[model samples]
Target: MDARRNDVNPQKYYVKKLCKIIYFMGLGDCWYERTEQSRMQKILYAIWATLINSFIILNTINELLAFLRTDLSVKEKNDSIQFRFAHPCLCGKYIFLVLQKHRIRALFERLLEASRSVYTVFEVEKRSVWQAKLCCLVLAASSYCTLLFTVVDAIVGYFTQGIKIRTEVVLYPTPAHSGLLINLLRLLIEVHWWCIVTNMILVDCLSSVAMVYVAHKLMIVKLYFQNLRQKVISNIGKKSDLEIQKEYEMDFITGVKLHKDALWCAKNIQYALGNVYSIQVFESITLLGMCMVKMAKIDINLTFILANGLYLVCVVIITGVYFSSAGNITYEAYEVHNAMFHSGWELAHLSPASRAVVLVAIQRSQVPVFLTAFGVVVLSHNNFISVVRASYSFFAVTY
Candidate 1:
């Protein structure tokens, strides 16, 4: 009886302690495992929540519009409204179901564990940084794809609902008369198309930049885990003062490596930022090309509005999201590095050869991401700014 009671006490004590740790860690009891998310994770959850809400709202609005256009019976109308309201709930349930896979659970649990290491006072291997970044890449890709689909849907909706138009008259071409006004009007059309097409390209470029930035972050995460694994194995052959300490370190190291690897593999491949960047680049360019072809058939006056107003708004939104996502990714990487550096692991303490390894790893892990993000922002912002200025110029000249 006493033995059983003792066993129960330890288990209960651990549970209570874990609960307290979780509470302080800022990760609520929502995750089944006791692991907590870093700042990035919390931000990701919030962003994802906002995205889901937006999608639901947009879908609901679309459905309502459809319902208003329909001449349905009272019962059918009520049923359709109810169905639309429940759609988001159903989608949530389905997402949960997918997350229930054992492999996925393992990956999530590993990531949660990694998140904790970022705060550890001891030398932490740098692998978790890569893992977190990879996760972000996956997440950002999913969001980008959804946003792309939304854009496509919006364009389709415009076609179905009919495009808004502004009036402009074209004078008949005359061989006998050289009218400067006619030439000027034609010039305006060319300028309008140029602004619209360029703006669309800029928005597409922003999307690509976001995707690439996320991918670069993932690479860092992978490096952190790899370094951690090498450290653990290297320490295995060394003699330590306490047998228990050796065993503990080895166990922790093995567990971390395994957890990271599991999570690394289980994540949604489709969500990877690597493919998202290239694919989006191709798709966006293609879509923009199509828009240009379509625009060619329409009047220059109408195109001017879309180019100046509609495309301008899209470029702004795309640039905003791109920069925001890049900032998040960079911040998370810094946090991971800060945590691991604090973990008592010093690059200087390692042997010369080991120090080289560590330095190489850090350089590879961080530099590419920063470069990609830098390039994206520079181009996206400049293009958007140029389009805005040119549009204003066109308006000023024409009016």
Candidate 2:
């Protein structure tokens, strides 16, 4: 095992390390196994997840009922309405995260499988590796910064005001009167909040990383097609007619196989993400509008407003990145047609059989590959822009 570990590439090593961290946090398991022990572990994790999910749901309901029972003016009514809506949305987001555990595990497994399959084609290629590394770094930096800000903000608030501030999606109910047992309970609640927040951040960041990695795989496949075109052009006139024809046929077959594999990889990714993709889109738009409404309100605290603003920005940026990467995948898939078109097949003087193979390849290349969310929304830069526009419109109306 040590020897095998040492044989791994630096990029893969770092990526696996990050995935392990995510798995240990109960976000998902990258090394999913079907052993008895693995089953037992998963069962335990599921129980814990269900407990946390139930707690959040119950707390949200309690908060909602409490808000409904209170008397308020028009402004307070607006605030209450917003808060009520926001709590359920937040709970739904957490529930989405929890329910996606198995899907996340499947995604990571597919990612590893795809990477291994394509490694020989891209082992020496630095561009995709660098892009993936940059993505991982960005996710890591953002997660750390956000968590640090939450912790420091809470600590500073407590020291300055002698009151603990909650920094998680679900607010814990604490007694107003202070006592030793109450203080201990508050500390435990804070710990639980931190754990939940940390898990949420890790899951989100790792999911983004997985998407970026899949995009890199698509890029590698595209590069392979480009290289195949070069091979077709370079092999021209170098050998006898029969030999050239054979070589072209061989290359064509290889290209088809690689393209099919790439498509299969993409299909797996889409399948894994399909269930939650639309939910994520709706959540982002709704949360962005809610944050904007909170920021517009006159009586909200600056710090709270700033936090929501940061969250809104992060949601926008993350959504943009995800859709942009999906767009790149589509572009790469479509570029195959151009590569085949420019490969100088006409100049190769191929036999009828070889020409037939090239024709089939060209036909296959003409079909554009796309990743869709919930089998409805195609993930692309254009769609990303549309979502942002719609979100902004919603915010304007609400404001």
Largest lDDT belongs to which candidate?
2
Per-model TM-score on C-alpha atoms:
0.30, 0.77
lDDT of 2 by residue, 299-364 (tens): 545555555556676667667766877787788778767876665567557778778878888888
Models, CA RMSD each? 18.3, 5.0
What are the per-residue Cα lDDT tens digits for candidate 1 across 1-399? 000112122222322343343233222332335465699987876675555435434543444454653344342343344334333333332233234334333433443344433422111223323333443444345434433443454354347554212111112222123468856644453333233223233223323333332343343444444455455446554745344344434433443443344234323322322233322222333333333433344334442434423433443444444434444444554544443333223422444564454455444334322313212422233343543454445434433
Prediction 2 global C-alpha lDDT: 0.61
Residue 97's lDDT in candidate 2: 55
* C-alpha lDDT score of every prediction, in listed order: 0.37, 0.61
Worst lDDT window (10 residues) for model 1?
1-10
Question: What ranges in model 2 sit over 4 Å off?
Answer: 1-15, 32-111, 114-119, 123-129, 140-164, 168-177, 300-302
